[model samples]
Target: MTLPTTEDRDPQSIGLSAKPDEEVLAHILQRQIVALEAARDAMPQIAGAAAALHAAAASGGKIGYAGAGSAGLTALTDCLELPGTFGFPADRMRILYAGGAKNLMTLAGVHEDDSEAGFKDFQESGLGSRDVLIAVSASGTTPYTLSAVQAANDAGTETIGIANNADTPLLREATHAVLLKTPAEVIAGSTRLGAASAQKAALNMMSTLVALRLGHAVRGHMVNLVADNEKLRLRAQRILQDLTGCTPDDAAIALQNAGGRVKTAALMLLKNLDVDTADRTLALHDGNLRPFL
Candidate 1:
């Protein structure tokens, strides 16, 4: 039987270990570039998925991510950061990893084959017609990931499948398929390299587009980011200053008055409104700041 492209041995792997350190590093970097290019090639699919997610979020729905192994880690990373990065609520996100938290540290390969666990986990996530689920698998054949997508489909949730290989079950089953056609791994079947890179890049693009569509991002600024930390608070102030052309002190005061909401603070400064009015106006526009800006 012919191996999938993701499992094929790359010619570049020949003599890789025997090569000079610089040559080995260069080959790895080159393959990463190839993987990123594959992600770029899937931009249309990613955008479609992002549109679905944005609609879901707008309607007060959840976004769920499912995967296994390195792909699962990538999905988890993206899921965990949405709240802080775009002010998306943590409770509105779900993660359906194969083994739950039991194998998170080890990521045992056995869990990837547990289709029942995948289906059960997704079912228990409570995501339905109003929600979106994104599942990632390097080979597009991991049983766990595929099952989660299947469960999502059965639950009437929109599903997006991200995978490295072409024409596999996960891709076929999903509502939207993002094929990141990364080249055969230099390390031969070790998807942690190119495949994981492509998945991460594709997910990053998809989520960023969703944020933009939701009006959480403005002029490349994460205006709706949760200012929970010192660094993020400083960033919120900077965003307020840059967008509203307000002094640093004014930005600080506005942020305080707006409860550390960068978008509301900007609106307050730009429209010369009180905090309550700015908040109400933002709500009137569905939390979008573009019209006020």
Candidate 2:
């Protein structure tokens, strides 16, 4: 039987068990570099997916991520970080794991094949044409992930699929397929290594680009980050100080006047506007700071 590329054994690791520690580490590092290169080659597809996601966000639609096993965990991490990293609204995001949210803490492998569960989760979540769903599966044939894609399609949702194989069902079914096409893992079928690395890189590209398109990022800085903690509050102050030629103390005052909103505070400092005017300006500009600068 012909094995999938992800399942094939790598010749470099044939004697991995007997190799020295440094040599084994080097071998794994080499494969990781290859995985990153594969992901880089897929950037065109990732950019397209980002554009689709930006459209969905503009329409007030939620972004959903669905997957199984390691891929699911990676997708979940990306989904959860959006709110804090780019100030993407938490309510506008959803994560569909094979066994549900609780399974995130204790991964149960059996749920990876539960298609009915996938269908039901998407149904209950109310995914529709306005929403964008990103489905990830290293094998590109996980029944749970495919079922989620099918559900999203049935609801007229834009679906972006990320997989480590070519011509697989996950890629074939998705509206935009991002194929990483990385080589086999050092540990053979244990896809959590190389496959997961490629998937992570692809997702990072897609979500970060989407954030840039959404105006959450400005000049390589996260202008819309929520300053709910001390470290972030300090960072917000620094952002305003650097951008507006204000002292840290002045930035702190601006932050307070803007009610702890980093974007609004920066707007106030840069435009020399009062809190109310800066807030209004941000709202008028759709939360983007580039035009004001």
Per-candidate alpha-carbon RMSD to the true structure: 1.2, 1.1
lDDT of each: 0.90, 0.89
TM-score, cand. 2 vs. native: 0.97
TM-score of each: 0.97, 0.97
Each prediction's total of clashing residue pairs, residues at least 3 apart in sequence or on different chains, is 0, 0
| 151-224 per-residue lDDT for model 2 (tens digits) | 89989999999999899999999999999989989898888898899888888887788788878887778888
With candidate 2 superimposed using the best TM-score fit, by how many Å does residue 234's alpha carbon deviate from the native?
1.2
Q: Which candidate's lDDT is highest? A: 1
Query: lDDT per residue, candidate 1, 174-273, as tens digits?
Result: 9999999999998889999999998988888888888888899999899987676789889998898889888999998888888888888899999999
Where does model 1 exceed 4 Å of error? none
lDDT of 1 at 234: 90
